[model samples]
Target: MSHAHDHDPTVPREALIAIAAVLLAVMGLAGAVRLGIVPQSANPELSRAAANVAPAQQRNLRFADREDGAVLVTDADTGETVKVIGFGEGGFARATMRRMAKRRMHEGIGPLPPFTLTRWQNGALSLSDPQTGETAEIHGFGADHSATFAEMLEGARS
Candidate 1:
């Protein structure tokens, strides 16, 4: 037989199966994202999902406001600030004041974990738990002056 006549006409079935598997995985993940099942930075709003279910009086605790490009959201009943994060800069990031809280939690700062916070009209800060929906009292100054950031997941019951 001539050398050119020896070429195989069929591709291995293994290669075709592998390509199909990869495509399926990508599509499955995309579906989960659209259904609000997968959490990503692009979906920081996912945290809000956990914030729902507050009593009627506490329902107001969701997204509060958008100052400049930053968003103010937190649990309402306890008045703990959930996320004083930005929605405009690089998608979203912790606000300067909130970042200060992380850095100053120990230097005359407020309690760590089990503490969510909110700013009142009188300028007083209220602390809350992301899990229990309960709140504690706190002073707003130094690191405590920072926006309410949950110290840890242990703070949030869920």
Candidate 2:
């Protein structure tokens, strides 16, 4: 038996257990992500509600569109609603472009299509059709009331 007897039984057991634990942790993390958990490490979480609002407050940002199914942005962690800007129809980019064009701010925002930034009646912000019945009040894009819109508007700017 050429060098075939050099294995340790205890080592295999320990390694197998360790691998199982790692696999579990990975699965849990992936599950969390799929369940609307944003990766703070990759996206860099926004700390405050007023991180990137416009000075005049003429426009607020929004990214909580249902079409962008993977994304789950909010004004605040406890925020039940978000401000919606550029909630375009069609595909994600097409919707954004259409909305931006409506506002007379057409064109891509540094390769990213313009997302519509519309104000809600109650004030919660959102990025979907106002008629869709999924809107909430947002103070405005980058308003003191919401941070998600602020970030989206900033990101969309050329």
Candidate 3:
């Protein structure tokens, strides 16, 4: 004779309790931050600390993808093409611009306004979008990636 039984699969009581605890914790943290009980992060571009000092050099630039699959970096003030980074090269710069371009497209914004590239006295590099007020810290990515921007800065000065 075959025994007839129903097998019910369910989460353990411990798991349910743990999940509830985590959910509550997340809600509490969100509430605290929203209420300003937790301080917001400082803007690195404005910070005057030793590691994040004022910009030693700054340039306003715009980037566009060429029909040839290369990135064209242009000087915003002069309306001249500053540099043409090959399709595969300057990957970090290309990616950064792509992210900003996506955001601009989503916001119904055009690419007329330029992005500011700053090299801080403390050796920090940043890319800032004036239209969006968004800033990206370039140095955090590594020397190789940062050099791509650094080279742009040098080219802009020339």
Candidate 4:
């Protein structure tokens, strides 16, 4: 026995039309943002904070590899090779360099792209792959280290 109030379950036409209108409005807003017709920023404080950030400073050494299996650490500002860290069978420096190379390969970047070593204004040491937009922080702003990489950076500056 069916109850008198029983009927097909469905959304009301008014609700459906309201949903469609809201969806269309959202799409139009998204399209405007995508087309650069709408300004992304709405907060002046955030814009000021972004503008206040200090630029990254050039590091002492920039590392690049050669086809013949040589890791050349050079000056960050100048392209001059400060030292050549030979690619040995296995070592920390070699392993690190290999990881960077693998990341470049994964990103489908060419060898000619700039690989930068930067010391930010806050003194954090970082190795950056500009081509892939990947950055690895080597050490904290003022961390102490006596490793070969640290020594290399120091020597490059001198």
Per-prediction tally of clashes:
6, 24, 0, 0
RMSD to true structure for each model, in Å: 15.3, 14.5, 5.0, 9.5
Worst 10 residues of 2 by lDDT: 105-114
Backbone clash pairs for candidate 4 read none
Superposition error at 43 for model 4 (Å): 23
TM-score of 3: 0.72
How much lDDT does each candidate structure score? 0.46, 0.42, 0.83, 0.62
User: Which of the two candidates, 1 or 4, achieves a greater TM-score against the reference?
Assistant: 4
Residue runs of model 1 more than 4 Å from their true location after superposition: 43-158
lDDT of 3 by residue, 1-158 (tens): 65566566789899999999999999998888888997546646446563546678888998888898999988898888778999888888889889988888888889888999988877888888888877889999999999888887875552
lDDT of 4 by residue, 1-158 (tens): 77998987999999999999999999999899888898666433244357674434445445676798888777656677767876673266566656877898888875665666655455445666777766655663233331445555553332
Cα lDDT tens digits for candidate 1, 1-158: 56977877887899889999999999999988888798555422233346552321112334433657666655544667655555653231244334434444445545333334444333333444454444433333344433333231123332
- Best candidate, TM-score: 3
* Ranking according to TM-score, highest score first: 3, 4, 2, 1
- Regions of candidate 3 where Cα sits further than 4 Å from its true position: 1-37, 41-43, 49-52, 155-158
Q: lDDT: which is higher, 1 or 2?
A: 1
lDDT score, candidate 2, position 146: 58
Residue 151 deviation, candidate 2, in Å? Answer: 20
- Candidate 2 per-residue C-alpha lDDT over 9-108 given as tens digits, one digit per residue, 9 for 90 to 100: 5767878999999999999998887786845443211322334432232233233435644333333323334334434322443344345434433322
TM-score for every candidate vs. truth? Answer: 0.26, 0.26, 0.72, 0.47
